[model samples]
Target chain A: MGKPKKEPKIKRKTYIDTWRFLFQIGAFIAILVNPFLNYYFHVKVIQGWYQSIAFGHLWFVSPLEGIEALLITKIIYMPWIIGMTLPIIVALLLGRVFCSWICPINFFYEIMDRVHKKISKRSYYKRKPLFTLPRWILWVALVGELMLAMIVGKPIFVFLSPPGLVGREIMMAVFFHTLALEGIIVLIVLTTYLISQRFFCQYLCPLGALLAFIGAKRRLIIVQDMNTCHQCGFCDRACPWGIYPSRGEAEGIYCTNCGSCVAVCPFNARKFVFVGFTPSSEKLKLEKVPSGRQ
Target chain B: MKKENTSPKDSDKRNGEISRREFLRVLVGFSLTLPELAHAKSKFFSSPVHTNALRPPGAVPEDLFAGKCVRCGRCAEVCPYHCIEMLDIRHGLYAGTPIIYVDKIPCYLCMECTKVCPTGTLKPIPQEETRMGLAVVDKYRCITWKGEGICRSCYNACPYKDKAIYLDRLRPVVNKDHCTGCGLCTAACPVTPKAINIEPIYSFKVSKR
Candidate 1:
């Protein structure tokens, strides 16, 4: 995995590589215009998908509010079933793909990471993707906090979930005609990325953590052909999350499926593959150290 | 400095002090401490809704509604007339939840918001069956009841027409059983003090139930 066996024919990736870029733009446009149009054109609001595009109708944040509302009001708010199901299914399939493709804040984080590299000439992340309490621990923390608050009668996370804040910020901008404090928090988070590699996504963002937990059991993973992998370690250097791509392990929960490593690989060894599709991929699972290492 | 040569990834492979499952146990212990701070459990549950505010048609009773309502603003977004507004911090525990200001913009009875409610916060009752509240006529405030000018506007504005309100002896009288309490009549009342008003179902008072 150290030296190139000739220059490895780097082939262009298939459609999946750029689909995230298209999805990010699509979601951004929907989030930006849904509120303004829903307000001004309530006449045509009619019954459909476009309606939930409104600020308060944030699909992502709506589901999280159930615990708060149930605890505070004792009303179960069953409609949240719409808000929770699809994203979760995607997480189980692709593993936090929303962080890379749809999170507007993450779009800004990438720009900041680029700027940081230009200025400091060193990896902003001094360490590899820091193995925190794994995704499940954080997921429990979120649910426990919600249940605890519900029993106690004070709804939490309503004011705290970042996606909800993003919707609020967008709504205030469209309707109130003034920026609110939430925008400043977003700005602070974006600024943090310039100083630390993906600080907000890594240490904070409960929603991202939720997806990470669900995504822990995902099927699609970046596979590297050992025959072609000249471990010049460029893929590891290219990872924004600081994962060691040369490690040739099944991806961890933290992988955003952004495929930056695939794009950066000079050798065409790295490509996303559905592990169970072919019989041979059973061996491609993430390589763990022997059991006693811990 | 002595020559040391180990790849950074290999040297950092030692697992940290806490295993993922073990940390969950510690976190769960912390989770148990939260309910002790719990106090607002009954705030939105038992009705005679503290604020006495008008909600969208099919809204749950206030006491239980507050706990169930996430206040994501979806109801306001989907309302065809845009009559719904999220109450701000001034509403305390009910902040960001939907309320219909009867005089500013009354419920139009289009029944669109009910269809899109992601949660059961707004019960999906049909327009004919909706009992948002009962329309009560303040006879003392009505010029018609005072034997002055005959104002039939409340009766005329009632979506249920004769079923919800009727012209009796040239005065508008509300039939509570037939009334949806949409406040259309209240919004149309021409009398300066307003002759007809809808009593919100959850208004804190003698239980309407």
Candidate 2:
């Protein structure tokens, strides 16, 4: 008897992939033009201008805080404010495509990962010791930041901020303060980046930790059709955050929703499915297939 | 029989040593840059002296100190010019919070440093409202009043228009009422120990209105 043939998988482009590519290109242009824009317009222009204004002040350059400030300040009709908040709601419905595809830092990391892979010739390993350290450290830092803000009546995060550092560097370069102290800080940050991939986001970013905590649930994840997985492990290899997709739904704490796994899955079985509230019975059925193969 | 690979613990120990070395290197580099960072932070965080306090009523604030005020100098930079700078010394504070020494340099009221502050540390006061201190002219060295010679430099520089220092028969007379205490006469005086000098105006306290 002939072996049963597997159902043909459909191949199509995901919105997540398109969005991620476009955002990365946009960020690059923004970084390049920030100086001229700031000088000519007399705006404290940065990549996170919308977020900064929303936050009442530039608080650590994250859109999340800016969104929180908007909610607190009750400023309506801000397009960027709307843009930032919509994705979280969408994440609840469609899963964390925002982290994987929309975050500028994540986009930078993916590009870095490709370059690292090409240079090293060794396959990038997942679940390294340092990889798990960031989430815990970030949690601790967030608690400390809140306490310090209360005690000092000042936003302490602005001092050691990555985005602030980036803004200061751009300002120094444009204004010819390259010999100034802000210029030196830019050099230190660049050196740190050279040592590790996504050093700021994966390890030190309190904002990323906060987002991950909010999105940590198995129901909202990218699922695979086990019958078509083929154990090729393409999804596992493609995961930038070091998630093992073949091991089933993501743990959610580490997943940034960058959608790299979904884009690179050759079998086209991977689907970002929101599992909470109501579990997809179809996914449960697919999970019951025998371990070795179809 | 092939040799088995080392466990995760063994590899972790080796990586730990490398990371420790890197941490030390970063710490050393940070320490080397500490002095400059402290200076910049302190400059941005300190409070500035109110030079308008030395001026008389209705006197223009900018006429006191001239070219000497580039606004980039470290005086305003380290003034602790913030809301917090005020609150720091509010409770039975011994002498008031730090302000500029307007008697020596006179508050030119340039507002240059206020424009460059990143954290709004130095609140930008308008050129009209920034009162540092009232100016008091010393009559001892006045050429017109003391009969040293005919020097009307102070009379010419005074922006009050009616003249803070008027010449009465080639002798200088400071009209205390129209003087405005701007200290322009003091800065423009061509005498050692300054024939005209600005004294701190203690009576005209800054009213919020």
Candidate 3:
């Protein structure tokens, strides 16, 4: 009732959103099936090509894994460069598209979001402008810790990622055929999502944070035309991450580019556009949608 | 009027209330803290890596290998003979890394694993030059050494029959100079608790001449 009813004549662009869903499901299935392929078929389909375009790389180690190896054991696997380069190029070009279009974690979080809507009558999310460090400051502390780990000779953040945990567990379960205690950590993350909406995405995930850091200047952005938007905040309710879409003007470091808010808008005020090439449209008429924090 | 019976379940279902966010903040903290407890166990215990673990050929020294290996399992997957086995987490720091249990499944040394190694955790050395380890025979336990009509099993099975293993008074004597330590002889030896075993290079550090 909060949003105005749309005219049936307006054909909504649902296929693009469906494309994202299909990519997500397809990516998730590819990851879930990959570890079993080598074990069952005795064939190397990918042939250690962990860094594929489909799911990207699931290898636990990367050239950018940093000095954790050199500092800890004084050795470097020079070939790990194969693992790091492609993802860095992707992040530089596309931003954190993985979180929205590829990450399996989002699928699980979506399920938890439904459970929360049913069981818990709260829509509380502690987000944006975290303390004084702007929401965009996702990678600084962890990256700093990574440098320090190399200097100190110990890897600290190796297992901190939920996607990495999921990848590791799926690979372990298929190859070893036993659900190890590591699965418990994955369960805890799932339960955490139930308790807090987008807490990990907004505040914690380092991989997403790293991508956000690299992709902050990306041209592809979610733009909301202030002239049309009611600012009724229905888009806020629809957003699983609970971010106000109107505030983005265009790009946001924290935005996963999931497009749920765009799908729900009755007025059709939002659109994903390339701002880098646009002449006058590049000048975004940004209106602060009252973060209500001050 | 004050709300008295506010259970956490019935707790304010809306934002703008600081308590619920604080509760969520605490739950997030709890999630991270739970993993920290598991980490503490590793801190107190010694590394679970086996002392005499015979790694696949082309593996770098153990100390360096742990840092370099991503354990993608390419070496094991490409092996013409499935002699390579990836260690479980029970093997401690080297978990998911490749290992060889020569007794259960001996390496034929086709050298495919070396070429398939993406990270060079296992170096790409040819089969002939691979010094995986040195095979040592115990004279006392060997059936041939007991004068029981010379089994000759170790001599026949050795890839380098004359250079690596040769008959001395009808009993095989291992020549350390020419042995590549593929463990074929150890596996082929027709004796329980095989008389010959590879002294894995990682177990003891020695200068190569």
How would you encode candidate 3's per-residue C-alpha lDDT over A1-294 as one tens digit per residue?
124444433635555556777787787776677666767876555433222212222332333343344456554455455556666667666677778787778867765655665676654333232233345545665577567656644344443346655665676576656654555766776666644566567666666676777777876677776656766665676776656676652256677778777776766677666655766453552422333321
Residue range with the least summed lDDT across 10 consecutive positions in model 1 chain A: A46-55
> Which stretches of candidate 3 lie above 4 Å from their native place?
A1-11, A47-78, A111-141, A144-148, A151-161, A277-294, B1-52, B80-82, B202-209
What's the true lDDT of residue B28 in model 3? 94
lDDT of the candidates, in the order given: 0.64, 0.47, 0.63
Chain A TM-score from candidate 1: 0.74
lDDT of 1 by residue, A1-294 (tens): 335577556566555435656676676776666667777875334221221333344444333454355445543344565566666678788887878887777766665655666786764224343343343455666678676666756565664455555665666565546554435666777666544467677656666676777788888777776757666777777777645667753267678888877876766777787767767665654422222321
Q: Write the per-residue lDDT of candidate 2 for residues A149-183, one digit (tens) a residue.
A: 43543333433344444443443455333422433
lDDT of 2 by residue, B96-203 (tens): 112333334444445543443321223355654443444455667676677667877877877654455676786666665555454556667777767666554532
DockQ, Cα level, model 1: 0.20
Give me the runs in candidate 1 sitting further than 4 Å from their true place: A1-4, A7-18, A41-83, A114-141, A175-188, A242-250, A286-294, B1-52, B89-93, B146-148, B191-195, B203-209
Docking class of 3: incorrect
In every candidate, how many clashes are there? 23, 32, 0
Which is better, 1 or 2, measured by TM-score?
1
Between candidates 1 and 3, name the one with more favorable lDDT.
1
RMSD of each: 12.3, 12.8, 9.7
Model 1 CAPRI quality = incorrect
- Model 3 chain A worst lDDT run, 10 consecutive residues: A48-57
Q: State the lDDT at A80 in candidate 3.
A: 53
